[model samples]
Target: MESMKNRESKTAGSLIDDPVILRLFERMPHSVQESFTEEQLMHLKVAVGSRGWGEHAVDVRGSFRGWRHRYYYVMLFGRNRRHLTPGQKRIHNLISAAMLTGFVCVGLLIGLLGLYLLKSAAGIDLFPDHSLGIWDWFNSN
Candidate 1:
């Protein structure tokens, strides 16, 4: 039998390679088994170069693709995210894709919302009114 440390390392490696796993961590607490071990999360934070939760930092050597895949897989399944019916993998994928896409969309929406809220709250426009479009500048005073 593989040593426990070896097993854990391999298991952790596998988990870090899937996107679904990554999402699970983002959405909720990990399973009971995962409650204590933060290796996967740590790996991700290392890969992302930040804490891996708030703002994303630059990729460390860009090898984080591996880290991201593993993170995603674990989060997608965790303890209960494996082996559906014949087509369930497809559904799972759609769900995973939707999760990521939703994150992007929500991020964009929040960014826009923040901009709007900031502008409205501060009553400050990014662009000045006195500044004319290039063409308008040529055409008028």
Candidate 2:
């Protein structure tokens, strides 16, 4: 029984020794801090520390010295970690499809316009005595 008590006290003491947990404990009122058990503190640490730092696909960090000063820089890029709802996913897909459709429509219009200009320049009129007047307007401009 004495050994068990000693072990429990050691575990609780170790939890208090953690700098992060110690800071959290110090911020709380003394009475409130003392109210929490070691298990509760362990749980709090787990919850707060779950999402750790530097978890990224591309993480570049460096420090440099210039002109008697020190500078630090970090660049991070990675896939998003957010969890989107089904509705949001659908909206994102719809927007992507709309953008792709708009690009294709614009490309086709530009290609057709170029072909029409080429035909007009070659003087190849598919219909006799009928003109779209585009060639005339283009020439005037």
Candidate number of the best lDDT: 2
Which regions of candidate 2 are displaced past 4 Å? 1-81
The 10-residue segment of model 1 with minimum total lDDT is: 70-79
Which pairs clash in model 2?
none
lDDT of 2: 0.79
**Cα lDDT tens digits for candidate 2, 1-141:** 223234347845566677677768677886677666667777988876566553788999899998999999999889777789999999999999999999999999999888988999999989999988888998999
Number of the top-ranking candidate, with TM-score as the measure: 2
Model 1 Cα displacement at 9 (Å)? Answer: 50
Off by over 4 Å in 1: 1-78, 84-86, 126-141
lDDT of 2 at 60: 93
Under the 3 Å rule for N, CA and C atoms, how many clashes does model 2 have?
A: 0
